[model samples]
Target: MDKLTSMNVFVRVAKAGSFAGGARDLDISRAMATKHIMHLEGVLGTRLFNRTTRSLSLTDVGASYLERCQQVLLEVEEMEAAVTHLQTEPRGVLRISAPPVIGSTHIAHAVSEFLKIHSDLTIEMIIQSSPGDLIDEGIDVAIFLGALDDTSMFARKLASSSLVVCGSPDYFEQYGIPETPEDLENHSCLVNWAIAPRNKWLFKGEAGYTGINVSGRMQANVADPIRIAAISGLGLVMLPTYIVGRDIEKGRLKVVLEDYTSPPLDVHAVYPHRKYLSAKVRSFMDFLQEWLEHRVSVIPPVME
Candidate 1:
């Protein structure tokens, strides 16, 4: 096989995690997959994989090479999209990565609506936690919140969400309610690990913003569980307003320190900067942009 085919085989094997799996995905024989990998490794003079009887994994160098190879392959796909843009519609697999909560609460719905009209498009979504490296992870588009420090990537503002400091009404009633940020020092605080100051919850409002280091019996990295804990009267959790909106409205949870709430987190659709975008990427982005315009909120950023 040629270099492009070799790279394709390598990426498929790396993603599939086994020669048999890659062969199944590519509709080729396991023997052919093994031969292609062997040829590529021989040309490169490296052992790309460490294989066992039942499993396969990339070697350290192979792990790094797979990232670069996927980008190169994507660039080639983009070139093809540019050539076919006038004659063909955006119709291909668009891989997306997003934080679990955001993907579940919002993006998934938007993607479903998008697929209604773009019938030829396919979507592969990975629901990951916050603080994941998007480009190295090999995704076409990433939906996330807060500050994106990397200037090399492109980010488009999608929406905003506010942070809520609250708990169940029963919990507040039992704890006698926290009258000020300083009161949180003795309160049970549920921490979201995605927030940098793990012990200190940030609040912004009439007092011009402050960080309160809190002690709690519960802490988690994801919002779903945090919400559950708060609803069950576990403790006061500082979560994005969007995540806890219905809960608060339904009296399942209560909002506290509203006067000291922080500003909203800006949600963005981020992608690697490139000369051309594949049809899959372009269509997905356009659909997302249209969908986001409707969900624009004045609230603060969530766990992502």
Candidate 2:
């Protein structure tokens, strides 16, 4: 029997809760289903399902293996689709959405480079203020920042992005550098306009996690404006390190709060299966996964 066929039979048995039920569903006899599962168990040397007279259940190992089995199946499907997509010479518009900072800096660069190679591709890049339902909007691909807790989507983590607390030299000169989380209150705090719980800036403190209530006269819904304001020495900004990293290095902005950086956020490229992935989305995701993992290094040296 084919390995995939046996695994498929085993998956059905585990899911349906009985060999008899699995056979009925797969249109095979119970004896064949038993043999198929027996072969799979013998090969792996683990009992996947525990059977009793009244009910069927999976053992601890069986439970864990089932999830892995499902993931393996999805990967196999994706691999086949990828081959098909590549062979088809993927020509079409690739619509991409991401947060403004990432889209403008990293993703946009990758897209431009990708177009150089696959010249037929065109992209509609939307720098979103917030994320939305991909399934609802017909969005081909969504480039997302931060750890994804959305179980509804399949997330491929591209990289870990760090945070930076920075202000203009003038702002820090006037207000002073904050060596600790407590010092943030003494200085003006600039914030992103769209962040939920907008008034709070998170920090990792010596004791544990802490959130500081911030008050600043200037705030904006996007990165460019906030960055412009910060560079002009208006107020302090706590941003993902990538956004201000170049400015900080160029001496346009000064980094502060070395001991109090937030935990890294995982950047991800996500999409709806959309039945099957088009060549455009698949190709770009492959590109982004590489770029974010290797190309972008936004972690600033621990502030001196």
Candidate 3:
């Protein structure tokens, strides 16, 4: 049996979790798929799947082998891609993932301009607040804000936006403005639970970086909802300037604690590490860096 072909079939079977499903995906028959798995198990002297009438699942050894198979397949794919497209221009579908607010506001525009420049290239943008598994999703690139927790992936800084603590004038009038980070404890602060550290908001104060535990009636896993709540005078909110800069300019919200700066929100283009990066990924990364630099430069300065 061809080991590489068997590995590919096994991977598809593992991912699909059914012989018929895997066979359909590869355009092969279920009998062929079974033969491949049987060959693999015979060679390894173990069962790869715990088969039953009700369900199909991987055994302990199968789970470990599946991970290695994925890595090998990915490497082989990248190698082939590098050789086939050595001098070819970037063309084909480019998959991207990003936070909803940033994706809709900024990345949408960037992609529009990028597509206009590269006529042969198409884009599939997934607007998700949470960072989903890039490999499982077949995402070519992902736009991330703030610090990245996964160090295994490669990252390139696109731009940075300052975080601002702001509230509606009506809200300030009702609750009074917070004079310091600690004062946030006394005020009802709207929280974007999507951001890390949860209810604890961070700032640079006299004693250096400090986190203030804040509470309010409103909390959400997305930025827009909290922003809407703040605009409606429900509570104070700390958000990136990119989200609230226009609101502040129009006098809908007023930034407080300007003296104490929150950490800058760094935007990044992240991708899985590869020996040879694809032309589509490389070209888009370059385009995004240039696009965002211009975009960030034009943001209206926040008022004191």
User: Tens digits of per-residue lDDT for model 1 on 1-304?
Assistant: 6988988999998899889889899999999999999988999999999988887889998998899999999999999877787235777777788887878867888888888888878888888875357668778888877777778788778777777798998898788799888998988888888655678887765657678888788778778887898898889988777777777767888888877767666788888866567767777777787766556463323222
RMSD of each: 17.3, 14.6, 15.7
**In order, what lDDT does every prediction score?**
0.80, 0.77, 0.88
Residues 140-234 of candidate 3 have per-residue lDDT tens digits of 89998878999988889999877889999999999899988899999989999867689989998778878999999899988889999999999
- Overall local distance difference test of candidate 2: 0.77
In the range 117-156, model 2's lDDT, one tens digit per residue, is 8877778888885557887876778887765767887767
Tell me how many residue pairs clash in candidate 2.
0
Q: What is the Å distance of residue 125 in model 2 from its true position?
A: 2.2
Residues forming the 10-long window of minimal summed lDDT in candidate 3: 295-304
lDDT of 2 at 264: 70
Of 2 and 3, the candidate ahead on lDDT is 3
Name the lDDT of candidate 1. 0.80
Deviation from native of the Cα of residue 140 in model 3, angstroms:
0.3
Q: What would the TM-score be for candidate 2 when compared with the true structure?
A: 0.65
Model 3 segments more than 4 A misplaced: 1-88, 297-304
